[model samples]
Target: MSGLVVHSARKVDADGLVDDFWFVADDGVIIATGTGIGWHAAAQGPGRDVVDAGGHWLTPGFIDLHCHGGGGHPFDDGPEEMLEALATHRAHGTTRSLVSHVANPLASLRESLSIVADLVAVDPLILGSHLEGPFLAPSRRGAHDGAFLRDPGPEMVEELIGAARGTMRVATIAPELPNALESIGVLIEAGVVVSVGHTDADYDQAARAFEVGARMLGHAFNAMNGIHHRAPGPIIAAFENPDVTLELIVDGLHVHPKVAKLAFTAAPGRVALVTDAMAAAGAHDGDYRLGGLNVTVRDGLAVLSGTSTIAGSTLTQDVALRNAVTLVGLDPVHAVAALTHTPAHALGEDHRLGRLHAGYAADAVILDHDWTVRRVFADGVPSADPHCTPARFRMRYSFCQAGLFAYAYR
Candidate 1:
């Protein structure tokens, strides 16, 4: 009979926007949602706690489809470090995440995947593991170690799949690799959502991967071919595929604001905002490691130790949401959808993970009218205040077709 009910709020989800919204959840699943004072009757049971949103921005908790680590702990380190990283993102309203692993030795990757599988078995918040390397193109390896770079050979793919033990939800493969077209089919057959990235694939080559069931484009415009008049490349191929989702990192360091806005216009509901964060995310900037490579994070920009090669990121989903509205000129409702529903769809988990409808998870991120995360509720349990503070918190306003967008930094 115990339940958590939130009433009188501005809610945005699959239904777009609903003012004076209310939803009641019991045993970690939403049982009903309505408008005005409708939640009163549903929340009459014992052990009920009601909160007045007062018309603040309330949306579903973010789902990070691609994230390495945070809170000064790398997902590749071990189970404890992975849990710590999970905690860090959860505080920032990422209720669910996939453990992303960079290129590493097969043994190391297997161990990490095993650890992730163990955690996913017990933690519903852990979506599963994502293989971002070992099957990548060496020429566009970005921040991954080159030594472990290899083609998506069937034997290697089978081994990693075995290591993940049914917990492998997503992987990025370069379409230009030998046997990659067939590998994409194999991965899809194994229930893994395949993405084409870290590739030197041309437009046709990328199209071939999608033809074989590649459902996502990994961190579009980063570590992949750019849009050339003659060579449209994988990004264009992804844009053409209606079923594909494009992952974007809008931390201001990885992409230009204008280009990011183009993604929204081109793909609409298909763009998923992923942090692609390393350990420095939600933690102090300094030295960190992604696999065996040394990374230096200064001013929130993470790069390789001795070169200008961009590393992962120091971004959380909340900051990405704000940047989407303010910097990228996206509607607040659309931006929230990218953080919640789109990513969940990418993993085929939207049935229960995304949206604020009945039978969905009781996870919600309550934000102030200014779009700042005031609190987060996951599994019917509330969180402490969001530990999200970027280096600068200036209020910058940008007028676009989406109206006046406000940013936390200039």
Candidate 2:
């Protein structure tokens, strides 16, 4: 790839935000960064490709650890659909993401994991798979299928982990379930991030899960119990644990602006702003399905059929950033960190994925003053490939059948 010199932009770095800064990158890695008066002159050398941002905001590419689908495609299907779903997110400034799959049958979940593993090999931006179900509380199952919920047995966890081939970045489970603490230990040992979610786990049970290595509170305060004056609930338990990272969906519907602000103050830098979006995220409000569960999207909020329970969100990282700053009243630097650095750390990729530093992956998003995506670069090059399409095909072919009949028949 040719050297890229980005000029005339405000740069948000790991330390803080800077103005009148310039960046130089090659082979998808940041090579140099400088600020102030003569930076524009220094960036005008020959043989260097330049991107004049025209005074846009330049920050590290957004990293989303939990997202289902977007652009009318869901991740519960296959690679074609997964890539399609991811493209919509990329256009919205999510440069890297873990394809989050809802609870499904064991066979389907395994197939999705294998498909995501293959995609990761070809696409560096496809970080991995996050199994968000099949081991959650029935009462707070959210959009997951209640029939598929189960205890996290060692054998079952091993099977899912094996399918991921070490690409299983996170597994959300209820700490109150049988063998849940033990499963947390097993998942942690296998390099999987254990998150406590969709549970009725009180403070004591939640604390024990954290002790056993659960490091995340998935969508804190949504699928779990509320904070009682006396009980304190799982959210409080998670906040007290310094090792834990809290995933907060900053969309005004999933979480109130004040609640989101409280999370930032309570957890500080430990909060990760995730989309937790479903298929209708980048699409218009309409009917959609999540993991075979019927959902209705109205006024940009998704709700399960016949219930007030929120299915997922239609939020994007850009909106999450905007809400953090405009609604939640957080500093742009801390808000950016929640969307970038904090989420990267939660996925155990802080060393590479987050921040605009040398040696980090050349994944970044350029946003206008309104925080809309103007340009996105992945792996040191603009993703101008037309094949980077959204997942819209709702085929019924399973991966096993697709491998047998589709390839063979073709």
Candidate 3:
């Protein structure tokens, strides 16, 4: 790869704002960063490529830890479909993402994990895979097919780990299931990040999961117990634990703005803003399905066709960032970190992925004053033109296999 320098920008990252900031990237990593006219001297020499941002809002590229699909495709499909699914999200500034799979037959789930492992070999942007299923509470199996839900038995856990081939990043489990604690230990031993979700577990039950090494509250306050005066619930249990990262879907549909703000305040830097979007995210609102369940998308809200149960959402990280700032009343620095740094830390990649400092990956997003994505870069190369029009494929049964915990019947 060639060298890249983005100059004349107002950069906001972990170190906060820097006026007229400029950075240099060579061989796919940030080499230098400073404020002022130093870039002029660097550009004076040959073999240097530079971009005049004209004072756009620069931020680290958004990292989404929990997303099923976007565009008109879902992650459960093959590689071509996975890339198609991410095109809309990539244009909207999500430079790195984890492919999440919903519940399925054990054999099918193993195949999905191996597929992600292969993709990761070619695309570092494909961080890994996140399993959101097969071990959740049936009572709270929001969109997941109840038939696929099972106990997190040790043998079953080993089967998934072997299939992922070291690329399984996270697995969401309901802690109340029988033998769940032992399964959590086995998953942790294999270096998988465990998350508690889609459960009827109370505060103490959820707390026990956390103590056993589950570090995330999967899409907090949803598919789980709600907080009451006497019952603090799982979300409260997450808040009380400093090591926990609270995943908040700030789409205004899944979580209220006030409630989202409360999470930011309670968890502070521990909140990760995720878009639990399915195939309709950046596509037209219409008929769709998630994992064999018919879904209707009206006004961008996706729900099971015959019921009020939300299947997933039609959201992208750009809209999520805009909402975090405009609706939730958060500072740009904090809001941006929620999208970038927090999630990176949750996945234990903060050393190189989330910050815009020297030695970090040259991943960044240039935003307009209103927070809309204008340009994006990953590994020193600019993405295709931000004015992207995704090819609308005919919605089919294969496309509906978009996965997330609490999905539909298969």
Candidate 4:
């Protein structure tokens, strides 16, 4: 009888948008749902709190499978810094995240993983740690420190798995490296979601890796081969695989809008929109360090100090969703799914966290009419002040069709 009930909202989930929807949450799980005044019946209890959404948009909380850092703190720094960064993203609708660390020495990587594991024990929002790591191809090492790149050795894999202490949710590896396939098997066997990334792997090699339990392709078309008339690369390999999820950094800087549209059109529900973000995310653009590599942020784009090699982004999940809708020409429902269920499914958390349904986790984001985050809740607890007025960004509709789409859904 004690719970939180939200009413008078436009609900979006994997199924699509529902008008005048309401849901109730108790003990961190959704317990009931309906449309209209039925929520009034549950609103009378002593321990129940009612949230009048006032015709706002409510969707399941966002899940970011690949995120390095945000709010001027890198995940590799320490537990406090990592938490500080997670707070920033949480305000922008990322309710749960896999803390991603770039390539570092084995000892440093292990230390970071251990710290994240400890945090995971204390914070339900900290899903686990993601190692975008030492097991990368040197040529494809984007923002990762070059000196720390190495082949995925079995001993190193075992050490990392131990360091994470059952909290390693995902690990990125170069599938073409020697012993890489063996390492993929090792990590997958240990319950890690193996991701093919930072690699020179061709179509065949990438397909083989996917066949052997590598379920994710990291940041499509960046730091990897491109699709050509004759050379269909890892992106195509991922597209062809029925079970693979392709991660797209839809910040408009990482991949072109047309190409991103192609990814959405080709992959459909399989595209997981990720913020391969760094320390500069949710912070002012300036000098920063990513995985021990010097990065300069100019015009909101992060790159190696003096090179054109694009580094990680400063994007938050809300902005990525905006780009998916306004820039990449995706339906709002599919864009929300890319941020919610697709990534949650990537980490095998769809059973609880991805949808606004009975028996699901009580995580949600209330967005304004233009898709700006108005409020966020993790486990039914509000993460940011509801009174904080969100800054509105003007949407450029060059690629978007002219229409009154929001009211049409209702």
lDDT of 2 by residue, 1-410 (tens): 76677777887745698887777887788877777554455456666677887888988889898899988878887676676688788877888999998999999999999888866765678889999999999999989999988888988999999999889999999989998888888899999999999999999999989988899999988999989999899999988998899999999888889988888888889999999999998888888889989999889989998878899999889889888889999998998999889988887789987888778887777888877778877777764222244333212223454353121100
- Tens-digit per-residue lDDT, 1-410, candidate 4: 24788999999889899999999899888999999899998899778878999899998999999998888888888765786677778889998999998999999999999877766765677899998898999989988888998888888899999999999999999999999999999999999999999999999999999999999999998989999889898999999998999999999999999999999888989999999989899887899888788899999999999998888999999999989999998998999999999999898888888999999989999898888988787888767643342222111111125321111100
- lDDT by residue for model 3 over 1-410, one digit each (tens)? 78888999999876788889999889889989988888888776566778887899999999998888877787777666777787678878888999998898888889999878876766677899999999999999998889899999999999999999999999999999999999999999999999999999999999999999999999998899988999999999999999999999999999999999999999999999999989898887888767657778899998989889988889999899999999999999999999999999999999998899999999999999998888888887776445757443211122233442221111
Using alpha carbons, what is the TM-score of model 4? Answer: 0.93
Alpha carbon lDDT of each predicted model = 0.88, 0.84, 0.87, 0.87
Query: Regarding lDDT, does 2 or 4 come out ahead?
Result: 4
| Candidates, ranked, TM-score | 3, 4, 1, 2
Once model 2 is optimally superposed onto the true structure by TM-score, how far is the C-alpha of residue 91 displaced, in angstroms?
0.2
TM-score of each model, in listed order: 0.93, 0.92, 0.94, 0.93
**Alpha-carbon RMSD to native, per candidate:** 9.3, 4.0, 5.5, 9.5
In candidate 1, where is summed lDDT lowest over 10 consecutive residues? 389-398
Candidate number that wins on TM-score, 2 or 4 = 4
Off by over 4 Å in 4: 386-410
**Candidate 1: deviation at residue 124, Å?**
0.6
Cα lDDT of model 2 overall? 0.84
Clashing pairs in 4: none
Could you tell which candidate, 1 or 3, scores higher by lDDT?
1
Candidate 3 TM-score, true structure as reference: 0.94
3 against 4, candidate with superior TM-score: 3
Residue range 30-149, candidate 1, lDDT tens digits: 999999888888778788878889899999999999999988988899776786787778888898899999999999999888877877766677889999988999999999999988
- Segments of candidate 3 deviating more than 4 angstroms: 390-410
